[model samples]
Target: MEIIGFIAATLTTAAFLPQVYKTWKTKDVSALSLPMLLMFFVGVFIWLIYGYYKNSPSMIVANAITLCSAFLLIYFKIKYAKTP
Candidate 1:
């Protein structure tokens, strides 16, 4: 079960890397929604807290990495937002 948890965590956490990489390299956040990113960041942060309380190493590690990626996306979205 723990192995399954780690596997799930690794896959889910890794899923965010491509988006992060693309946003970093392209500096284009026009397609990313600010509200969605903000919501995701908050949800991941809450998951991290829950993980800590639950003593789930897999959840902690996954949420931590995902939280960073989500935060980066949010930053990119703001930084690269077009001026109107």
Candidate 2:
């Protein structure tokens, strides 16, 4: 079960890397939604807390990495916002 958890964690966490890299390289956040990102960040934070309480290493690691990615997306969205 723990191995399954770790595998799932690795796959899900890996999924976010491409987006982060793309955003970093292109600096194009026009397609990104701030509300969605904020919601995801909050949800991931909650999951992180839950994982901590449950002592699930997989959850903790995955959520921590995902939270960071979400945060970076949010930051990029704000930083790259076009001023009217």
Kindly report which residue pairs in candidate 2 clash with one another: none
Error of 1 at 77 (Å): 0.8
Per residue, candidate 2 scores C-alpha lDDT tens digits across 1-84 of 788889999999999999999999999899899999999999999999999999899999999999999999999999999975
Top TM-score model: 2
lDDT of 2: 0.95
Worst 10 residues of 2 by lDDT: 75-84
Q: lDDT score of model 1?
A: 0.92
- The local distance difference test score of each candidate is 0.92, 0.95
Q: Clashing residue pairs in candidate 1, if any?
A: none
For model 2, the stretches where C-alpha displacement exceeds 4 angstroms are none
Best-fitting candidate, scored by lDDT: 2
Against the correct fold, how does model 2 do in TM-score? 0.94
Candidate 1, residue 75: Cα displacement in angstroms equals: 1.1
Superposition error at 65 for model 1 (Å):
0.3
